[model samples]
Target: METNGKILKAGIILIAVLVVLGYLGVYLLTIKEPVFIKHYIEEQIYTGYQQGPRQVDLQLYYITNAGDNRVVSRVDFPEYPEIQVPASEYGMHGGFMTYTSGPQQTPGSVKGRYSMRTVYLGFSFEEDYYEETIEITKAVIHLSDGSVVETEIGSVTFHFDEERSEVLESRGGSGSGALETREFSVKEDIELIEVFSPILPVIQDSLEMKINGRDFKDIEGMNIEAGETFLVEANTQGSRGSQAFGEELRYLKFQPKLRFISEKGTEETRILVSGWYPIPNYEFIEIFQYLRQKGAL
Candidate 1:
C-alpha cells in the first residue's frame, strides 16, 4: 500500500512540472522577444509656410507587428517643396508678396523624378522599438540581402496643407508673348475716341504710344478721344519711333476708339459704336487659365 502511494505522489509531481514548463514555452514564443519585429508610422501632419526664415514640421505615427515579421518600409513623394509664389509675382497690381526658396534653391527640384529619401529600420526584437531619421523624398524597407519586404513598417509625408497653398498661388500673367493685336480703319468724317489703362513695366518706364505719326500726350487719369482714323504706333523707352509693337511689355490703354458705318436712311444721325477686343486666336486665350494654374507663365 505504501509503495503504491509513493508512485501516485511522484506521478502528480511530474505532471505538475510538465504543465508549468509547457506554459513557459508558450509564453516565450508568443509574447517574448523571440518572435518577429515590426516598425511602422501611423500618421503625419504638415504645418504651413513661414515668412523670411521658416521650417516645416511633419508628425508621424508608428507601430510594430504589421501582421508579419517585417522591418522596413519605403515611401515616395513626387511633389516635394511644392511650387508656390506670392500674389505680386503673378503680376496682379497690389501689395508686395514675396516668395523665396532655400539657399540652395530647393523649390521644385524633382524634375521628372521628385526628391528622394530612405529610412533604415535596423534589426528589431519583439521587445525593441525600431527608429531612424531621414531627410529624403523616398523611403524603403529591405533585408540585408536587399529583398523588399512589405512587413517592414513606417510612414512619412510632408506637412502638406500649408505648403500646398503655395503651389496654388503662383500663376497668372498677361505679357508681351501672350497678346494678339489687330488694326482697323475709321471713316474720315467720323470722330473717334479712345483711352488706355495703366501699362506694364509701369506707365513711367513702359512703351510710349503714338497715332498718325504724332505723339499724343499721355492722358494720365483722363480718357483719349480722337477724330477719324489714325495710324497706331508703339515704342519703348530707349528706342523711340521703333514700332516693333509688343517687343516691350506694355499695358494696353483702356477704351480704344470705336467706329461703324451709318444707315443710309439715318444719314443725319450718328452711329452708336463702342468696345474693341484683342485679335488673338481664341484657343490661346482659353489656355490662359490653365497656364496660370500651373504657374507656367
Candidate 2:
C-alpha cells in the first residue's frame, strides 16, 4: 500500500511539471520580437506637369516594448530625410486603428501589428521619380537592446499628378480620369449646348465641329437648336500647333459669335469659347514585362 501511494504521488508531480513546462514554452513562443508594421498606400499618384518642391509621406509602425517590453531607441529613414516641413515624426501607442487588444485593453489578447507605434516621415525625391512612381527598397528599425534590423514592409509604389492633369488609366483607385462628361468651354445664353466628345482637348479661332456625328462641313449652315452636342477641333495656329492636331497641350480660345433667339423673343450672343487639357503620361509600367522584353531582369 505504501509503495502504491508513493507511485501515485510521483505520477501527479510528473504531470504537473510537464504541464508547467508546456505553458512556459508556449508563453516564450508568444513573446515575439517587435516587428515593423508598414502601411499600405496607394500605388498610383498624380502631380503637375511642372516640377517644384514636393513631399512624399512615408510611415513605419512597430511594437515598442514587445515581450520584455522595453522602449524603442530610435527609428531612421536613411533613404528619405524629413525635409523642411512641420509634421509628426513618431508617436507612442498611436496610429493603431486596427485590431488592437492586449492586457491593457482586453483581458488576454496580443497587442501589436495594427495597434502599434506610428512613424511618419516626409521627404522629397528626384523629379524623375515623381514623374513616374516612387519605389521603397528598404527600411531600418533600431530596437531598445541596441539591435538594428532592416526589413521591407507593405506596398512600395507611389504615384503623383497635378490637380489639373487628367489620368487616362489607373491601377490604383478613381481619379479625375474616371470623369467622362461633355465639359463646356463656352456657351451662348442657351440652355443645352454641349460638346459631344467624351474627352475634348481645347480649340480656338477656327474649329472643325462635328454635329451629331456628321462633319460640320457636311452640315454647314445647319441651324442647331437647343439640347445638342458637337465635337470641336482647333484650326488656329499656336505653339503646339506643330504637335498632335487635336491633342495639343495649349488652350483653344475664340470669341463666341453665334447668335441665339430666346423663347421671349430676345437675342443673346455667346461671349467666348476656350479649352485646355493635359493628358497624364504618368502611367504605370509593368516592370516584369518590361524586363522580360528587354532580356534583363
Candidate 3:
C-alpha cells in the first residue's frame, strides 16, 4: 500500500508539471507573438496636352510579415471633370479685331483666340492626418504662350477641419492677375496641360480667358481701325474635388469676368463669358502597372 501511494503521488506531480508547460507554450504561440503591419502611400501627377481625360493616381499599400506586398486600394483622382471646357457667356463675341465689309458677320467669320493660365499649387499637412491645416508651399503657372510663371499673386487655403473640404477661400486682385501679361494665342482647339499638387490627392483650382476677333465695322458707327492696340483682361475662379477611390464628386461652380479696353484706356467693354471650365479626369491602369513594378502596389 505504501509503495502504491508513493507512485500515485509521483504521477500527480508529473501531470501538474505537464499542464503548466502546455499553458506556457500556448501563451507564447498565440498571445505573445509580434505582429508587424506597414503602410505605403503614394501620389502620381499627370499633366499632358492630350485631349483625353487627365488623372492622378493615389495608391495605398499594405504589407504584413516583412515581404508580403499587396495593393490594398487604388484611388483615381481626375483633374478634369467636364466633357468640354465651360463656354463663355457671350458665346464667343468678346474681343477687338479688324473690320471688313461683308454680309453682317457670320459666326464662321469670327476667329476665337483662347488664352489659358493654369496654376499648380502644392500643399503639405503638418502630419499624416487631415485634421491639420494645409500649407501652400508651391505655386506655378503655365501660360498660353507656353511660358511658365511663378508668382505669389493669389492665396490658396484648404479647410479639412470641417466635415466637407472647402477650397479657394480667396482668389483675385492685382496679385491674382500676376500672369495677366503672359497670354497664349490659340486657334481651332488647344488644351492646356492639367495642373496638379502632389501633396494632396486632388486639383486645387483653375482660370481661363477667350477672346473673339470681329470686324471693326460690326460696331454701329464706331470708327476703330484695325491694328489698334487693345487691352484684354480675364478674371476667373474655379474649384473641383478629388475623385479618389471611385468616390462621388461634388460638381464645381466657376466665376469668370471678360473685358476689352482700347490701348488709350478711353473705351472699355465687358463681355459675358462662362466661368465653369473642365478639369482633367484620370484613368488608373497605367498608374497601377507602374506602382506594381516599383513593388509599391
Per-residue C-alpha lDDT of model 2 across residues 89-153, encoded as one tens digit per residue = 23223423334465333211123311234455555555566565454545666655677777655
TM-score of 1: 0.20
- Report the number of the highest-TM-score candidate: 2
Model 2 ranges off by over 4 Å: 1-23, 30-32, 37-39, 43-52, 56-58, 63-65, 71-117, 124-129, 163-297
The lowest-lDDT stretch of 10 consecutive residues in candidate 1 is 108-117
Q: Which RMSD does model 1 reach against the true structure?
A: 28.0
lDDT tens readout by residue for model 1, 87-202: 11112232224454743222111111111112222211111111212223232323323454332222221112222211112122222431322333332333223332212223
Q: Compared to the true structure, candidate 2 yields what TM-score?
A: 0.34
lDDT of 3 by residue, 134-196 (tens): 222222323223444332221122323222111111122232421232222222122111221
- Superposed by TM-score, candidate 2 places the C-alpha of residue 129 at a distance from the truth, in angstroms, of 4.8
At residue 227, give the lDDT of candidate 3.
33
RMSD of each: 28.0, 18.3, 26.6
lDDT scores in order: 0.28, 0.39, 0.27
Candidate 1 residue 254 C-alpha distance from true site, Å: 8.6
- TM-scores, in order shown? 0.20, 0.34, 0.17
